[model samples]
Target: MPVTTDLVQQVLRLANEVNAFAKQCGRADLSQTLVEVAARWKETETTIVVAGAQKRGKSRLINALVGRPGLLPVDADVATNCHLTLRRGPVLSATVHRNDGDVEIDPEQIADYASTTGDPAKRRDVLGVDVTMDHPLLDGVRLLDTPGVDSLTLGHRQATVAILQRADALLFALSAQDQPVLRHELEFLAEAMERVQAVAFVLTKVEDSANAQALLEENRRRLATFVADAGRSSPGTAAALAPLLEAPWLPVSAKLAEAAAAQRSLGREDRAAKLQERSGMGPLEDYIRACAGGRELTRSATVVSACVSVLSSLTAVAEDDVASASEDGAEAARRLAEVDKALEELTRTMRDRRRHAVGNQFLGREVSAIVRARLARVRQPYEQAISELGTRAALERYLAQLPESVEQSIRAAWDDIVAEVSRLVGRALNEFLAALGLEPMEMDLAKLSMPTVWSHELQSEPGESAKLDLLREGVPAATMAVTIGMALAHLNPIGFLIGPAIAAAVMSRRREWEQVHRNQAALRRLVSEQFTQAAGEITLALEREVASWRVAVEETADIALAGQRKELEARRAELRAPAGRSAADRGQARRRAADRLARAGELTERALALRGEIGPAVNALA
Candidate 1:
């Protein structure tokens, strides 16, 4: 069954009941763990860290994503000097957290506290700005805008790196205008892949570059080479990092998006939508949504895992009772001892997996490597041609065909990876549950699809016909006749003036229409140019629909998206946050333990039933 919030909520309800029963029976350890798990579940968020080289439109992209232009500081002279966190809240608010304390500030004054040119004393003390606004997109997601990672400033780089360590995902921005992906970018990406779980590369300022597609191809090749070489040092980590090579590398125009936003506010819905479509923000938004969904799945799975742990504890206690009371008590005691050992080992394994998120990371790297190898095999000929030919035109043609050539391979790889990951993770998790005497659980992981490849080529179009229509439509025949008649009235000065005035008015209206049409025509060409490249992939019949292909890839591949670490660690940390449990008298504890033994079997049965439901719910989400 498809994952639903209600399913997770039901699991939580069962968990809460288990917690209450444990508390009533004075099992403080289990009850405390349950409380912490529930708290972590409630606080779960997908933290996406936006990082990039300077002047790559990272800030603008965030602004566009949230539909709040200029919300974050974006001045070239005073770029984002510190990290800035954006999340949802009841109303728009901004606060600067520092060692001293958090200081509330107006949203407009964010630059004053967060940018390089901000008040020196305030900037030095500022940790980062915590911005909360009523944006629907920010729901259950936290956006962290970091200083350019390529900054020469030690503090800027360090701050960005620190944020990267905690990020659930990374949105690494690059510019299409900036060609030949730099060594520093590859270095940062290598470091970032080690730190963050999931990453999606964005090619910003596509509108500014005529060869955005070529640039994207070049960047992908360079990044792949870097990742491949990096993988050679540590094959496991490299294999885990492989899937990221196929992660969405979208080309977008922040300039067009901001203009679209302006037009939308001015009630130019048609124009706004056209510009927005051309901006390539729609696919980017969809990718972000997919990330959020993947995170929700991770959080849900973590909660269910916690429930299973509690159930295991209860069952063990029930087994202890059986050993104490039954005739075959010695055998029961031996089995219980074995169960205890398994539980201890399983707990440690789960903790280690959660701490490092290594399982999924390794799986992701392997999946990525598979995709890269397949694509490389297909592109080998083209690579050879480029090496042999070594001509600008030949290289450009090769770049144009690069994404299209690999499109089929990517889709196939996506399907294969999804099935493989589900199979592998399911087997591992079942083995884990089996040790605690639980039934095997079905794993229905979310199947993430490859992103659509978009390429645009703009060509100039004549607007003379449009300009003529503008004049004809703006000035009616009746008005033109009256003006001419008045001008002919004995060469009347006022009549002559009126004619020129009417002509000037018509010309002005013509200019406005011309400008509008020019923009519309440009947008149309941009879109047309994109499909011209995609024609080979899409059938002629399918090409009739303009907006249809836009939705082809609804989800981004989140194979590398982090595991249960965030929630599990939060559970562990919160469980440890409070002081240790107060000690009770030995006699009192023995008596209580004996008293609870009578009802332990009944509690265990209830927990076993709950565990059955919890596994499926977790699997559905995972």
Candidate 2:
């Protein structure tokens, strides 16, 4: 397997073990961090941004780099408006970012959305374009073709500057026909070098200039001089650009490279190989691959360093706790008793505080008031709609929409409750930590609260069986009574026919009105029940999080005390032994202490070894 693959596998294995350990130790926060770090390592990709001034053939160079001609638009007006991101996929796909949301478009239509030239109204909303191709060159590497740094359009310049901030490496393209190093290019490079991990200068359009070699050499010298001069004013900029300044400049004809790729695709291998050699794109491609490999190594090292630091700190803390507990005789016993008392008192106080916070009538009232206010905003419109419903079909339609409306209202109310509860829990935890004379642990209550899962459960659509039950039980009883009364009051034609018909119609409306009210009342009850359940669940989760935090703190002290007690007990047992007066007994105790110290030394050596491994990985990037 490749080094990248081997390194990733090692990292994932370590992360899994650490995550399990963290959970066992009740360190969910640390476990979550490890999980996220593993995920980031898995998704890591080397991103290169090709940026330069207008008409410098940046897009052409990118297309040639990927060995896919016309993959990116080459026209100046079309290519210089917005940033284009190219990556690998199974098939060609493109999406345009707009103010509303992303819109998928045909790969051929990318130029229209990315350009500002054709139909201003049609492309006005487009923010950027992302394209994915099936080219092997794009695997594990993404290329961003940015707008010209010195474009006449201010937006293009700003967008390029912004994109530079996120680029892992920058390929600065300069036209061979232009001066070796312009002031604008120098300024952009200075800013970009500070933000990106690596930088390289490319002298483009070499076919158009007979003195391309001279331009490349002269530009390299100019860059070195610029860095030397900038060091006097800004040492940081000089240091950041040192790698690029030491690297050689690459000069290539993007047109020739594109022609080579096209010819190869047409089966003209001989002509294509000659054109590719003259284009000098191979050296540039090799340099990019080296930079990408270096970046991956550096990134892996950084993540490993972080993980090692966390684990090492935890181990050191644990060892210190054990050492502190293994003290001698009566003094150790006294310390243990004191710690036990403090832990007991702290536990009691914390429990009381949690109960007070959760069971507080004031908090419940505040939550209820807010929920009611949100519900009231939707209730009026819902009631009006129900009242205006005229026929059985209309009533059925209204009933069908009722659950969704009620769910929306409940969700909104639940969101407010969650925010408020998080604030309360945070405040309570802070107070408890203060009482224990310890700094508060950083906690994200919202994340730990499991809001999404709870919300989904609470907002599930009500069953059709329940809806039918409400209609059947509440509507027909009143309607039947009214029909019987109307039949008995009528005898003549007017009273018998028209009166009964009017009465029956009125009674049906009344029954529907009652059923609608009943349904609303039932919905209100269901919302209240969900709110109470959510509150209880949140309260319990908060208690567990705080309790776990408290346990970790106490466990440290407890471990220390336990070690001391064990040492004291061992001494007592030795003193009571038949050979208590012998020198061999003293020798045994000394050997035990020495063995413990040796174990501690071993742990320290392992930590140092882990730290030592990171340095070479980082240096390999240079």
Q: Flag clash pairs in model 2.
A: 325-560, 325-563, 325-564
Per-residue lDDT tens digits for candidate 2, residues 269-312, read 99999999989898888767765776655444434444544464
**What lDDT would each prediction earn against the true structure?**
0.60, 0.60
Under the 3 Å rule for N, CA and C atoms, how many clashes does model 1 have?
6
Off by over 4 Å in 2: 1-42, 77-81, 151-153, 298-622
RMSD of 2: 21.5
lDDT of 1 at 212: 93
**TM-scores, all models, native as reference:** 0.43, 0.43
lDDT of model number 2: 0.60
Superposed by TM-score, candidate 2 places the C-alpha of residue 146 at a distance from the truth, in angstroms, of 0.6
